[model samples]
Target chain A: MTQAVATNDRATTFDVAAVRADFPILARNVHKKPLVYLDNAASSQKPRQVIEAVDQYYRRHNANVHRGLHTLSDEATAAYEAAREKVRGFINAAEIAEVIFTKGTTEAINLVAASYGRAHLSAGDEVLITYMEHHSNIVPWQMICEQTGAVLRVCPINERGELLLDAFEKLLSDKTRVVAFNHISNALGTVNPVKKMVKMAHAVGAVTVVDGAQAVPHQRIDVRDLDCDFYAFSGHKMFAPTGIGILYGKRYLLEQMPPYQGGGDMIKTVSFEKTVYNELPSKFEAGTPIIAGAVGLGAAVDYLERVGLDAVSAYEHSLLEYGDQRLKSVPGLRMIGDAVDKTSVFSFVMEGAHPHDIGTILSHTGVAVRTGHHCTEPLMKFFKVPGTVRASLAFYNTREEIDQLVDGLAKVREMLL
Target chain B: MNAAAPDLQDLYRRTIKGQAALFSQRRPPAIVTHRCEGSNPNCGDHLALALHLEDVAIAALGFEGESCLICRASAVMMADTLAGATVAQAHEFSRRLDAFLHDGQPLPGPLATTRCLEGVRAYPSRLSCALLPWQTLTRCIQPDPTYATTHLEAKP
Candidate 1:
């Protein structure tokens, strides 16, 4: 792959300082030191562009959308719809009707489980998921399976955290009604072969649902290209606000499924006797949606587009490699999840210090890494670790910050050991 | 780096770090009668407490699982302090530890070494780590001699 050459040379081209300038939080000191936010897997620091977009919405165009005929309502509706269009284009979904707004990836997954899985799955049906899935992905399927009297099957990962495709193939059967998996593992940073997996799942007549929460930030996602039935992602991880996310489902599928939540907007006409559901996108968005959050997400999309995701992806690849090289110097630091095609995440355990101690120590030096199972408790159990100290990178992150992380880890070792 | 920033030494006191490193003092007995598991959902700190009780007294106690330095150190220190103590005394000790951490009450005489954990109160997020062991203890000895206060009384 040209990944190595492209990233090494593209380093000079990707101006990180310029990107860093756009994020105000990066300038703030954590404790007494410059904030080196390595917890992008959990959430990303928002750019001023997104912050101002939300601010502008509240300051100028604050109104309830879709219902009101006032000027403010019209503007709010226009902006919110514009955000949906942006999201639709961002994921290259088949139609705007397929994009549904929800609270976040967790809720999006739950919606699909409650609506689609409930209707389709039954006793003797199987729901397939991976060992590396976040709790959001795993628990929803479990809840749905439990409700439907369906069985849950897990595709196991190898020692290096790569999905055993052969094992996954073996598990897929005619009884497999749904296959849910993560495009990129939040805990392990393993980039699953989505297209191949989707093809295999389709062979067994299993509809595919991808948890793209961690993938969307590091790579461009095209739901149509992957041929997955449903793609779920969170806005906050992609530099948008919390409490806003998107679920891209195929038009034909969403047309058949019932509304997830029964509320004001999800219904076209409701009476005591009968209730008619709204169309595809509106059917799922039950209540007054996160309007300002949508605007912020649109601005975040605009900012990422301006930077060019190709450059961002390439830059992060180099950063990940550089981080790997630098962290080798940290004696007794055991790297977890070294999958071949992983993205910008490093989960590790130190010999002497606990992951929490490492996190606590590193934060003192202003390196904000995540510690624990990363909402993937099953994966952590598979790896035989209590939890891990994870440093997940973004395009705004610099090599210098990685160096700082390494230094901080060395200090953590010294203090803890 | 800002000079005003809190030092790691403040959180990682020598005694606590030493306790975490040794961990030898925390070992399960040959026969564990009571077992309780506690987990901190936020940071994924999990711990299992095992109590080998003889006639309502803690004959031996130990823990196994993954947790933070504060939690591990606290668990190690806890095992040392509660060995041979009756279930009633164990409950009393938990209340005193809770009061000491939350309400600034003096630690019982036996657990003076655990005072090093007081440093964790400054880092509110780490307080749960320090309390997981105690909470697991409360969960282990239930119904008969309940601890007066909850594990995380202040909800740090």
Candidate 2:
């Protein structure tokens, strides 16, 4: 909402060209045209620094962490643990012990559902989640509820794709055990007021789990300030590698919850009679972790710190505004989400062309976009659309790319209509 | 069908455009012998196919639902071509069409309207759109146990 810092026809706070240079894939062409990637909500392009870090780990420090006493093992273990510290600082978690690594955001949420939800929720209990949540967030709770005999309640969203806080409050009851929702809607880009929602859940004596997969790349997150019991996010969404993510849970809660899975590294000691579990984060991290992925994520955090999230956020907001205005000019193009607080995601449907058709057309022009329900099937039903062509932006994206996207859509209209 | 020539026109040729535009005017039969819904869950396309069988011959064929251009066009052209075909003949045509789309073979005769769709053979990802209706029609006649539910997918 604030004025974008621009000087001499350039965004002063952020330089998109420089950011693009750091990502090697941005230089490549798709279908003989320069690639205009707008699918950051699914996964962001990795920076050269992050890529090098992962490569370096594999080249020099490749070893299974935490067990071997060799020099390579020590370096790998140090880098992997240091990545945990970076994540703890990234979200401002209370302690390093609260940060546990998993495969990705989906696995992180599943971990919480399998452990916390199963242990606490029982018959007649409730798990409240927003309708706009990705299936990863929704289905895990559904599984937990099905197992515990607890009811799963959904908070409604308006036509604008904004969650109805009033409905969320009403859904909260004495038996409400957990409240889980996305910090930003991946399909719609609606930014939920998670802090206020977490407080409301706390009022009902319920713990909150925030899906920060889409939010972490766009804004600076302070988990302690939001006071959510659990926060899950993906590394791939934040310029880190796939198959690596973080789950930040309150120590007191994690201490009581059972381990998500049983495996080698999670055990403290083994005997013929019984096996004692490891402490804190190690208890939750069952198998050998993605050491190289953690190292890559650490480098990505360093890159973001140098670029500054505040500047990145401001530049992206301006781009979102420009994209929204340009997309509105395309005749018969209906924008799906118009939440007041939104990121640089434009989901729309042309009058005659289906989203898949539009996406296929755009792909020819090297304008990559996502076309589907985006795993938010319930939200699609609410909007009365089968799916939408979603163009999600990142800080490295420029205004010219958005112009190309609008031009591509015009071509789609000509061909299909 | 060359991947090197990745043109949008190749996929949305004139034939496909015309068929997609003409789909709305075609009406569904008043009565149906067998009906099933086919969906590409990845892209949220829905195709509801119905058949009217008169002594194992397709007396009338109709469909209702929404999908991408390739899918709509394929469904419309398929219904128009297969109306009077027997169950076995319809399946045979579908088999040949599948072979053509997948193996890059020549499209079979009696499927003249769908020939222009040979362009879709290049775009592997969009191939499912062109095959959705035919697959649904197969389910309608054969009645696979997997597709017994309203929703039918190419794979289990």
Candidate 3:
């Protein structure tokens, strides 16, 4: 909030320096040191384009969207709906109607659990998820399970934090009415084979819900190609503002499920006897939505498109490789997840220090890293750790910043070990 | 502003580090007499205290948990000082430790090693870590205590 927006796009191939310039917070200092922010999985820093979009929306078209006789209302409605279209195009969803806006990934997942799982699940039925899911993906299904008397089954992960695909398939019986799992682990950075898993779940007549919160920021996501029945992701994790997220459900599924909440925009007609519901997305989005957040997300999708996801993915892969190799210089620091495929997260633990101590030491060095269970308490239990220090990288992060993290780890060793 | 690195070096003194090292050795008793478990839900620091009470007086104390050095140090040092104190003295120690951390009050003789944690008062976020054990010890003396939590704000 303290920085200015500068659209400094130097034309180069995956130029991280130019990319970093677009985000002003990267230029600041924390604790008198150049801030090395590696907490992207928690929520990514926003770019100038996204910030300008939200600013322009409030400045020019500050009005409630959907229906009004005024000009500002019409402009707001067009921009808000245009934002939805941008999101639909970004994820390559088949129809804009399939994209519904919610608060965040948590709300999107809960909407599916409340609307779909509540209607479909019954006593003695099963809802399957992996051990690596965040509490957002886990607790919603548990609530629905408690409501419907359905059993919640967890597909186990291996020691490397990779989902056991064989065990995931074994857990998918005909009784499993819903299957929910993250496309990538926020805590461990293990990228699950979602397309393969979705196919396996569909083979057993179960619909799959993919938590794409961690994946959307790192790679290109084609909902049609992945063929997940429902894909959920947040805007803030992809360089946009918070309070806006997208849930891309199959048209047939969205049409079949009832409304998650009953309010103004969701209803076509309300009488003392009965009320007629509205169309696809509006039927799900019940209230006055986060219009400015949607506009910011739209601009974010544009920025990512202009930058190109393939370039971002390849560059971040190189960064991940460099970080993995460089972090080995730290003594007594061991990685928690050793999956064959990983994104930008480096979750680790030091030998003699607790993660909170490591986190405080890192903070003192002006390096921002998340240190906790990351809302994956069951996964932490599986790994036999209280918590792990997670340094989740973004494309804007440079190799020099990673070296600073290593230096900070040395300070932690000097003080704690 | 740049004094943090040196301040941290000064904070984790020998007494704090030595007492924190004792945290792992301070295990739960096999007899399961007067043992209490508590946790800081914010950072997942679990603390279990085992104490021996001899007719309204404390005879022995030990702790087992994974927390920061400040927390482990506070728990271990408190256990060491309050080992043979009466029940009222244990409560007094807890109250005085709260005062020292919050209001900068000077600690008495047996709690002299606890002075190493004076730096903790500057970081309010770390206060719960230092207070987790004392609160749990308070629960051990309570007749019907279920769980423990550290509330850092001004209480009504």
* Index of the highest-DockQ prediction: 2
In candidate 1 chain B, what residue range of length 10 has the lowest lDDT sum?
B147-156
Question: Residues A264-361, candidate 3, lDDT per residue (tens digit)?
Answer: 99999999999999998899988899999999999999999998887788778878888999886677989999899999999999998889888877
Model 3 earns a TM-score of 0.92
- Residues A215-264 of candidate 2 have per-residue lDDT tens digits of 99999999999999999999999999998999999999999999999998
Docking class of 1: acceptable
Model 3 CAPRI rating: acceptable
Q: Sorted by lDDT, highest first, which candidate order results?
A: 2, 3, 1
Which scores greater on lDDT, model 2 or model 3? 2
Write candidate 1's Cα lDDT for A344-382 as tens digits. Answer: 999998896778788888888889999877888889889
**Distance from true location, Cα of B55 in model 3, Å:** 5.0
The C-alpha stretches of model 2 lying farther than 4 A from their native spots are A1-11, B1-3, B143-145, B148-156
> What TM-score does the first chain of candidate 2 have?
0.97
**By TM-score, highest first, what's the ranking?**
2, 1, 3
The lowest-lDDT stretch of 10 consecutive residues in candidate 3 chain A is A1-10
Whole-model lDDT values for every prediction: 0.86, 0.88, 0.87
Q: Evaluate every candidate with DockQ and list the scores.
A: 0.45, 0.50, 0.38
